[model samples]
Target: MQRNTLGNTGLEVGPLCIGTSTLAGFTETYGYDVDDERAVETVLAVFDSEVNYLDTGNNYGKDGLAERRVGEAIRRRGGLPEGFVLQTKVDADPVTGDYSGARVRRSLEESLERLGVDHLPVLALHDPEFMSADQDGFGPGGALEALVAIRDEGIADHLAVASGSVEVTQRYLDTGAFDVVLNHNRFTLLNREAQDLFEGARDKGLGVLNAAPYGGGMLVKGPAQQPKYCYGERDEAFAASALAMAEACEAAGVPLAAAALQFSTRSPLVDSTVVGISRPERIRETLALLAVEIPPALWVELESLRPDARI
Candidate 1:
């Protein structure tokens, strides 16, 4: 439960952050389901723990239902404790697919309404690949422009970019517009493509939130239980490689989940590691995984098993 300063933002967060994507019910994006009562319980459990950071998004579920659930959890608690940080994303328009500055403003307004908060400590532009990479999103009157306005207005303390593509992520980071950069399903025990981007972000003095340390649940569930890497079904080669890593963890007396979580948090490139959860038990399990120790020899064995793509 120790905290780390998120680069130049001066925002302190735990090494482990609880992500709320699963708080929304079944969704095609994440392919998971959790009822309302359970989702609330899970979020409350994280709040009650030593963890102080919560990550969510506007498009986490159909029509941003996940944000509402998170809001409900806060309302149930009467109010969030002092120093607690809530982070969320302003997603691309569901219908128009626009990420213009105006769209960014509208998205934030909706998010604030749903979450029952006037402002956010962190607000990121989620999935920029969905828009025009050059002009529409990053140019004049672009999404970044709107984000900076929000920060200056005291509506959002920090602005960041979270993307599934390392190239897209690095481009935003290099602009020097965002305070933090969040890249997921990469920089894990199985993938290192984000390594270069992480280094670049650090050099620019930007914070790094390495998400999906479990490789979209594959590292935790193992290839046998979850055959997919990232969001797609794994190919035969990746399947074999993942299975081999699982076997290595088994033989070394280390849980693959523990190895993945530790591998992400231990890196100098990562300021915080984000893990998603659906139920209260999963929070406890993630905490246990974070506490479990991994041997140095096991890391050497893992270096030879890294996945190729950052996604």
Candidate 2:
């Protein structure tokens, strides 16, 4: 329930943010379901726990179904907390996969309508990699222009870029336009490339929101036994390394999920760590873990199990 100021955005948010990617229909990719009623309950549980920052996106579903669900949940509860903050991502066209300035404007307008809000607290570029060719989209007369316009018009309070690659993240940071940066896969025990980006964001005074702290569940389940994405295709050496980390957590009496969430927030570079939940009970479990402080000795043990150290 502790709050931290997100860089210089002047907005205070809880250390734990509720991510709505799964509720928006990205569950198959993460292996979950889009149960609206349950999702609403989870959001409510988050509020009850004093974690009011909710992260979502425009491209989360067929339209803005995820945003709508979030809006409905807040509305059903009478209203959000006095200072509750809602953040969401805006993506380029889902069909063409182009991230142009026009697409950015269109996406934001659609998201606002879906969320039933005139303005959003934070608006992040959904996928940085997808906008590689359109880095100019964030330049003058580009998507950045639209984002700035939205903020100026009171449709958004802050702008941010959520990316997987450190290089892509740097491009946005250099622009001096974004107030936050949501990073994925970089700060995990499996991949630390995002560590550099985190440093940069902190130095530049940009709020750092670490996503995929569990490496898309790989860390939670101890690296998928089967190969798929970069993290999933871990060879015996990598699997052994990940298992060792899991064992270390067990030996230290820490649940893998709890370790993942706590580890991400422990870093000074991370202002908040977003956790995606499909069920209401998961929210309670996360809150319980957050309330328990991890011993320093246990943290050192967990750090020692990092992949680089195993080799």
Indicate which candidate wins on lDDT: 1
Q: Provide the lowest-lDDT 10-residue window in model 1.
A: 302-311
Encode model 1's per-residue lDDT on 1-311: one tens digit a residue. Answer: 68899989999998988888767664554566788898888888987888899999998887888899998899998878678989999987888777789989999998988888898888999998778654477668988888888999999998889888998887887777799999998788777778888898898888899999887777887777767777686656666777778889999999988998999988989999999888888878888888888889999987777655313
Residue 109 CA error for candidate 2 (Å)?
1.1
lDDT of each: 0.84, 0.78
Shift in Å, residue 36, candidate 1: 0.8
For each candidate in turn, the TM-score is: 0.95, 0.90
RMSD of each: 2.2, 2.4
* Model 2 agreement with the true structure over 41-115: per-residue lDDT tens digits: 877777777777889898877777778888878788887777888888889887887677788888888887777
Instruction: Report the Cα lDDT for candidate 1.
Output: 0.84
Clashing pairs in 1: 190-307
Count backbone clashes in candidate 2.
1
